[model samples]
Target: MHFVTGGSFHGKAKWVQEHYSASRVAEGWFNGYEDASWETRDFTTSLVVLEGLEQLVKKVVEENVIGGRAALRGKLKLWLDWEASEPDRRLVLIGTDIGKGIVPLEKENRLWRDVTGWFYQDVVMAAERADVIWYGLPQALK
Candidate 1:
């Protein structure tokens, strides 16, 4: 699994697509300033937490299963329950507009930026590898 994240209009998704040809990508946008009603920070954090949990479940299931007919019934129930709880299993996550920058005027906006930046950091820590793209150049941060 690969997680690509960057600031606004940084082309994180494009880089991932170019390298991996990801068949599926899940995007989470925390529009902090635009919508006042939504808890964008909390939502983004939940999404990242869910992503890590789902990945762990996948690894567990993959490890338990072996081969043909027996594999189907071996750990199917355990895996099924886990899968049902979290259904969005994305192979790749392209998170855009998440970065650290100037402070916002509103509390929610400030919270959103801080949370998004933290979320990105958490993702990078959990990921096997992470890359930062700047000026059309890729640098491995982890």
Candidate 2:
């Protein structure tokens, strides 16, 4: 899995395409996916692009799941594991760095920032190649 993240509008998708040239790319957020059924789907030899991953986490945290950090981390791990199960498929997770800059006043927003940043760190550490994009340029961090 290749994890790529940056602030919004930083051209992460462009970088992914230019580098991987993956034929099948599927973007999430409007993905209509749920944990119960996600593992059954096929992702073999494909490139799955999940844009705005923070939003997905936020949604999950709000709706069904509970137990805070550990639960959230485990849920995310399951999702990522499903993506990685098909070894030939490359999962390109495009997320925004919401933990930077001024923090938000709203409690949920603050939590989102914290959790997203935390999860990103964990994900990056596990990824074979991790990148951060700035001004449409990619910096390979791992």
Candidate 3:
């Protein structure tokens, strides 16, 4: 269970793919006050989202006291339920356009930045034991 995220074109996914070749990355949903979707949400939202996921994971691990395939399945169901309830949790979010500094707008642009930022925060939390990749440079950020 790893979450890879970063600003647009930051190569987060590529890095993950390179490492976890067999891992599956899925897209999630968004629930924000603004119409720009991910653009306006704040970092706190990302933190909450990640915290929710961690809680869910803990629940799964606890339920899987027996430690078997059945328990794993049950834990997976827990994750599915969480995703159904919170679409945002289902996403492998990425921000591909934030190198030029903040955009000059108050609607979609801002929303995108905020959302991307928050998403990245969540990814960091979820993938706490993550490795940061920049310009082909990889660094551990746990």
Candidate 4:
């Protein structure tokens, strides 16, 4: 599994596409920005890209998932298992760096940021490769 993160509109999707242009021929991309329903997505392709992680986290916060991080971790574990089930399969997670900038004025927004930050940390720790993009440039973190 590979994790890619960066600020909003920082070219994260572009970088991931170029980085995996070869394997992307048969990739499945779940654009969470438009719809954060990845929990119900079924993957048939070897390369699965989950973009707009921040929005998904926001959804989680809005829904008030019980156990919060623990529950999210369990959900992530399911994807990890899916990736491990297929030797040739790849899972790429693209999240915006919402932890930066000024703190949110609203409590819900703050919770979203906090949970997203923690989620990113967990993914980075578990991912085989981690990268952070800045101004369309990528820097390897793992």
Candidate 5:
């Protein structure tokens, strides 16, 4: 598993595309911005790019489906298991960094930010590789 994170519109998607498009088509691209349903996705491709994970975190947190950090980790375990199921398969996760800048005034926004931060930490910990994109340049974090 690979994890990439950066501010919104910082070219994380473009970098991932260039890095993996040689072996994978656009069909493997999954945008959580459009649909945040992780359970409904079918992992049949060798390369799977899952972007907009912050949105998915927000959705799950807002829905109150996550009872605690353990619950969230369970969700991540599913994806990790999928990646480990195949030696040739690669799972690239892209999340926008939303914890920077001014803190949210609303409680809901604050909760989302906190949950997303925790989720990102979990991903980075489990990821075999991790990077942060800045101005379209990727800097390895792990």
Candidate 6:
């Protein structure tokens, strides 16, 4: 598992595509992976790029709310476990560094920031490799 994060439009996706050469890239929002058909596809032989995770965090935390953190984390873990099963495949995750910059004014925005930061911490901990892109340059964290 690889976690690639950075400020928005910092070429994280370009780096992933250049380095990994994926068959397909999946956008994140993580909208419906918990549904009954989540297990239908095997990620082997393909690289899955989960881009815009902070957007998902915003939706998950600020919007209608999806079950709660436990439920959301459970689904994430489920997906990670599935990805782990296939070494030949790769999962490249790209999230904007929402934790940086000035904090938001609204409570909902603040909540989104907090949740996204915390959730990204979790992902970095679990990831085998973590990279942050700045001005199209990638720096490895772990």
Give per-residue CA lDDT, model 5, range 112-133, as digits (tens): 9998899899999999999999
**Candidates ranked by TM-score, best first?**
4, 5, 6, 2, 1, 3
Model 1 error, position 76 (Å): 22
- Sliding window of 10 residues with minimal summed lDDT for model 6: 28-37
After superposition, candidate 1 runs with Cα above 4 Å error: 23-90
Cα displacement (Å) at residue 46, model 4: 0.3
**In model 6, where do residues sit more than 4 Å from their true spots?**
23-45, 63-67
Clash pairs for candidate 5? none
Steric clashes per prediction: 0, 0, 12, 0, 0, 0
What is the per-residue lDDT of model 1 for residues 1-142, given as tens digits with 9 covering 90 to 100?
3455556566664566567543223334322233322221333221321222222322333444323223323323333333346656323444554345567887645544554454455556555566766655667766
Score every model by TM-score. Answer: 0.49, 0.76, 0.40, 0.94, 0.92, 0.79
Worst 10 residues of 3 by lDDT: 46-55
Q: What are the per-residue Cα lDDT tens digits for candidate 6 across 35-141?
A: 32322345444456676777766666754555545545775787688777766656667788988889889988887788888788888988989999999998989
Task: Pick the winner on TM-score between candidates 1 and 4.
Answer: 4
Identify the candidate with maximal TM-score.
4
CA RMSD, predictions in order: 14.2, 4.0, 14.5, 1.9, 1.9, 4.5
Q: Is candidate 2 or candidate 3 better by TM-score?
A: 2
Q: How would you encode candidate 2's per-residue C-alpha lDDT over 1-142 as one tens digit per residue?
A: 6788888778876777677664323343123233323323554445666656676667655654455557656755765787667766666776777777998998877877777777787778777888999889989998
Q: How many backbone clashes does candidate 3 have?
A: 12
Model 4, residue 92: displacement in angstroms?
A: 0.1
Better of 1 and 5 by lDDT: 5
lDDT of each: 0.43, 0.67, 0.40, 0.87, 0.86, 0.70
Residue 106 miss distance in model 1 (angstroms): 0.4
Best by lDDT: 4
